[model samples]
Target: MPCCRLLWRPQRPNEDFRMNKQDLSEDTEVVLLLCGRFGGEKQEPHQPLSPREYSELAKWLNACNLRPSDLMTDAGRDALSSLQVARLESKRVEFLLGRGTAMALALERWARGGLWVISRGDMDYPKRLKRQLKHAAPPLLYGAGDKTLLEKGGLAIIGSRDASESALSYTRSIAARCAHEGLAVVSGGARGVDAAAMQGATEAGGYCIGVLANDLLKTSVNRQNRIGLQEGCLVLVSPFFPEAGFSAGNAMGRNRYIYTLADQALVIDSALRSGGTWEGAVENLKNGWVPLYVRTPGEGPGNVALVADGGLPFTLTADSTDSLVDLFASRPVDDVQSGSDIVETQQLLLVPEAMVTAEAVTAEIPSEPVQEKSQPLVSPEALASSPAPQPATATEVLAPSEAHASGDAVGTVEEPAMAEQPAQLLSCLSLDMYADFSAKLASLLGGGALSEEDIATQLCIEKSQAKAWLKRASEAGLVDKLKKPVRYALGRQGSLC
Candidate 1:
């Protein structure tokens, strides 16, 4: 079933629900206890755990074979008092978890305002954030509107809040083009370029996902957003308090969400050296989260330098807006950044306690053109990219000592291997180098059949990468491709039952 079900839809006033602790999932409630500030316009009574601190706590809990929900139980509470975890102070941990009253009151208010909260442990939490950001994924998310829209990948259009008229016009046109192509527009929902892009898409009857830094409660009831919410074309989410005011730190921190949530991002405008737009674009380029595209011809002061820093340049105008889809078609894999989840644990669960340490990884597959391969499973060739180059004439070399033992002539030789091979081939790296990367993948599948998204989240790789590897493995008879729901498992295991 789709995770975002309509629990309620009032014909008038639009008050959605009343989610008390009993109605909340155990993981969700625990996450709220650890990270939520839960109140409108009230001073924070206690410090919440930051991402790093939460990660440490998670690891410690995992080591103890305890889930976060376990901490809420009487026996689990008793165990916590007897246990000693250096990363988590007993008093602080207890204090945070004791905020059930505050959490309950806050949840009641949020639910009444047509708002909903999801924890990282919730199956509905945005997979892009967890897959791309890994442990840095926020522990909790507060949202309004159709949460389903969060997973619909689209073009993220970003720029300065005070962008020029030409830039704003182009941003709107490009966003409208995206809508025409049935794409969602992702943005920070701030004024200027963010607002302009969302406006263009909405006006064109397109979907959008907004990652707000603050004021989620107010936005939930904004008349302009009502139609979009009713039609399930928009979802506004925040990592901060719903009624919280905006701050510079919050704005900058939320920039990563805008980039990771999209398949591609366009820098409509940005100044050189500083500003949230510039920093976010620069960080995204360095992190390789997605292909960062900057506006050309109408390049901002920092646009040229952004391109120099690995941002792709594309020209988008009223005349060229139709090329939006073509622009997103190319996502080159460049550098591997840590936050990009180049390697990590099996992230099948949003509950940090359920996460396991990833097996050490030595493989780094480059995203390159594939040549014709012999195996034909899904199609005519293994990778099915480019035509392979002509192989050079074979050369002869002396046989190994094992051949001598087999009564072969001492000077007997064998032919050399093919001279030309596709860069995408693991053999190009070394014979059986696929083992380097395939171990974790095969291990994950060893349990049972799983879909592409599951495998990607488990192996902490991009969904595209997971799909490519699964296809190759299936062709090689290393994995069994199953029908019905579309899943995979190690074929060598002979299709479990």
Candidate 2:
């Protein structure tokens, strides 16, 4: 028997809502009072509540003697005892029955588990977000990618939606560099700079995550960024449910998420008082986030102001790539200024440092006999063109016999040359002690002898440095470093040993 056969048709609104239409303004006042009790404390009248009318609901909740715990079901007491339960239901009815009915569909998707929420007070919430947790903080967040990305350190790069071509190229280059050095990237998933950054990370074979203001499935208004999301190279996240539409307030609300998801913020381009990227970076700075400002030679006063006010300035030129790589090598675990702070954490992973060995690194000199081309004597024309040295004074000039004796006294150029050769060798030798040591070890090892410990003992260098140099030589195709007691030998397919 189908239970639906006995379904009672819902009465039309005009029939059931027959109560006197007294000043409905009074009903709104009552609703406002109820909102005040449920929401905590008084809210300024000018700052209206969210669609649910939680603004003044705190007063009504207190008047009703309701606590958050009251919402939980106990052995006997059930959800009906909860003011929150009643308010949520009533608000749902009001919205569904009124002009803003579309939001209910979004709420339905959320309730159906297609969405999950992170509240401001939730422990899983990002601590950095707490700084913006005042009235501006989003009440809840929804996400799709690794939620942990929100709590960990990452870099944020942003710029104008109408970004110039050069700006996009610069953003990609910097983002790729940052990602190659193992930093995560966070951005608003906007069309220009943000899309370029996310694309750059993907191209660099690095992970990049996107934060969106609207639903994951919906295309961003600037559809260029949408293609990246579709390609699976980027992760799209949003705070609103799948059915929610894009709105200005919703876009503004995502500003905090952009800043909170990153430890450092980079603004590639933005005007003074720029609503999107610049404002987010400004908010991040106030809350102690490190800001990286990128500027062209003449990007103008806004970038200058940011640089003057403690933002680290960087030029988006090819020459700065090495410096950029060094910047990205940093882990967010330490303060940006003191590179030493990272050493403690880094020391846990021990890899030998390469030692520059004398033999392996040296460029080979030609072994075959050298041939010399005969030099022509200075032409009479050339000699005539050259300026003659000033004639020596009578005291400066030596007698003919005296000049011959003086020439002999001046000594052989070959003698001086011979004297300088050993010193040059010694100086070259001094530059790379470890390399020289490794060559000796390689000779011993290639002869099918000598343990790494033996080489270390003979070389008078640390075991690690010895092994490192030997390994480096091997890597450079100079020698073979075998496992177990780690011995080094000249490579079988050798270079000019």
Candidate 3:
């Protein structure tokens, strides 16, 4: 209702006022001014505007053609009289004037600390949060360091602040592996697992996105973190004020930001009953925002329950860097098994013709009516001679075999020809005719770089469809063709868009 209260600290008499009003956008300056005015004071209750309140305010501003600064003007007062939220009369005007008067000093303080802010309307706000949280996303983000890192999705490593040394070590190793794979490491910027993961990623010359709940101004310039920040490998951001102290509610709420910003999440250790780590993991699983992984044989009961309740188990080895990359980069499967659990060696079996009895063949047939052998789907010679079929129409939806059958006629052929001779025919098939495969193709391309083969394997689409999607993506400037063999990476414009 009051848009939250501000607690102003007295500036030293000799403190330099280096920041000017021009340093920030008119909108941002006004928001900060409002925050400075109404935000919590020392020993006073600190009640920041709730997401719903922010949404309401945004709607009012839009409807009334009022910028935040307009609220302090004569016209603003007239407009405020018409808005329900600002109808409190004298008190509202008084508060607005108070904050407006302090705007200069507030800007100076923020500038002195090298602090910056992005409102929800800003283009630089993390797209992931905008997509995942939508209306509930933070209205403002105060941050420091490389803002571009926010655009790079990565693995989120989260756990208790007092995690076991082994758990922390596991997190660091996984983070390092993620770095080796060219992924950023996302964390809550807390102690133990979060800190270990961030440190590991930066130490490996990889990027890290730290979503801090409080004390962002203090933490961003920490001696240990300064190098990474300066190197553009670390970005620390928070939804709270730069000087806001730790609040349990803020910490728990910030977990969603960490999870939503990441491509996937790993839980090292969580208490079974409660705690920020446990609650966050549970909320993430419930929302299905990302694929949640819990360390197997984890240090706490929470791990066992999480796995039982659909959390995937992440088991890593010293040499599993490639496997780890694939795990996070690939889309999640219904089953919770990791790639490392899959055996790669192929097994060959020798089945004698005699082993396939007539009864066995008959049993394999579906109970549904089958086309008679007399009317073969496609005689071998006919398939070879016929031109490739045109894309199917909606009413003519047919399986590959059926489509082939309807196209041409020829004499029946031997079984071996039927099994091995149609490679050329299948290659000519147009996968665009299938809508489901087309959608999957688009999804895979947006996720990351993929060779045609990778798309086929990952999306379970046909090779031809994968190739077609890659070509389409290239044409649309959504992907770039790379090197020999033609792998595709998301195009610069594509990532920015």
Best TM-score among the predictions, by candidate number: 1
Stronger candidate by lDDT (1 vs 2): 1
lDDT of each: 0.62, 0.43, 0.57
Q: Where in model 3 is the C-alpha error above 4 Å? A: 1-22, 36-48, 65-75, 86-90, 333-497
Question: Per-residue lDDT for 327-372 in model 2, tens only?
Answer: 5455342334322322221221111224212221112111211212
In model 1, the worst 10-residue window by lDDT is 391-400
Residues 247-343 of candidate 3 have per-residue lDDT tens digits of: 5566667888999998889887665435666678878877888898877545553554465456776656545535777675564534553322311
- The candidate, 2 or 3, that scores higher on lDDT is 3
Number of colliding residue pairs in model 2: 20
Select the stronger candidate by TM-score from 1 and 3.
1
197-240 per-residue lDDT for model 1 (tens digits): 87778767899888887677777666557667778988888898
Q: What's the CA error at residue 29 for candidate 2, in Å?
A: 28
